[model samples]
Target: MNLFENAIKLRGFLAEDAKVPPSDGITEDAFSVLFLALMSGTWDIATNEWAPRTTVHRVVCPGPWFCGFTRGMKRGDYVEVEGELYIHDYDRPVVVEGERSTAKRYVSEIRAIQVRKLDRPLLVIDTGEDG
Candidate 1:
């Protein structure tokens, strides 16, 4: 028996509106792509301070169902995503030491299974007084 899984769940703000390829007379076959930015922090033992980090992930949502579902999403909107991890490889032109060359680039993205828009929590001010 063999067991293997590749899954990811992320909650973050949308970096920008969902992008889709221009219609080629077939709108129902387009794929919706989303850029999600997640923030995190870690305590540095040596520096004794907090280190902040932000990771941007590309999420691909396929089919007309996902496209319509994500149509209302925009930049700065908080959302949750569940998906499988996938790595895509492509060739890109790069200049190396003043020489133009085509290089293979690999990008890791999530193939979204589900997506949900989440309401952000409001900040509350606390005063040290009994009501």
Candidate 2:
């Protein structure tokens, strides 16, 4: 499922059992990359209702996969869903990216949510129904 579904379905599980994973390295996958791209696109999709300007990088796949990397991804870090982040999976329909060995499995504790910045502008994940 995508972020929206993760929120509605996976979040419950995270809060209960998804041990708040200690910051660590992680791998990545195609699914993770695609998801992030869609999320990045949400910004422009919300403002304009027509052909967009400048081919923006809605999302960027961080390559086929990385070996030893962490979630230091900034607003422009071609992310590929770096395994489990700071989640507390409590056994629910959570989305996991596997584990740290290859990837850090994770569940969306917070999805389709906004940043806590008064002027940083809002960010929305377009978790379409297809997910």
Best prediction by lDDT? 1
List where candidate 1 sits over 4 angstroms from the true fold: 20-26, 95-101, 123-131
Worst 10 residues of 2 by lDDT: 9-18
**TM-score (C-alpha) between model 2 and the true structure:** 0.18
For model 1, residues 69-105, the per-residue Cα lDDT tens digits are 8877899999999999999899999998999999999
The sequence of per-residue lDDT tens digits that candidate 2 reaches over residues 1-131 is 46542322111101111111233433243211222322212335666655433222221223223211222333433322322223443433444575333334444322222111123334697898997
Alpha-carbon lDDT, every model: 0.88, 0.28
Question: How much does candidate 1 score in TM-score?
Answer: 0.78
lDDT for 30 (candidate 2): 23
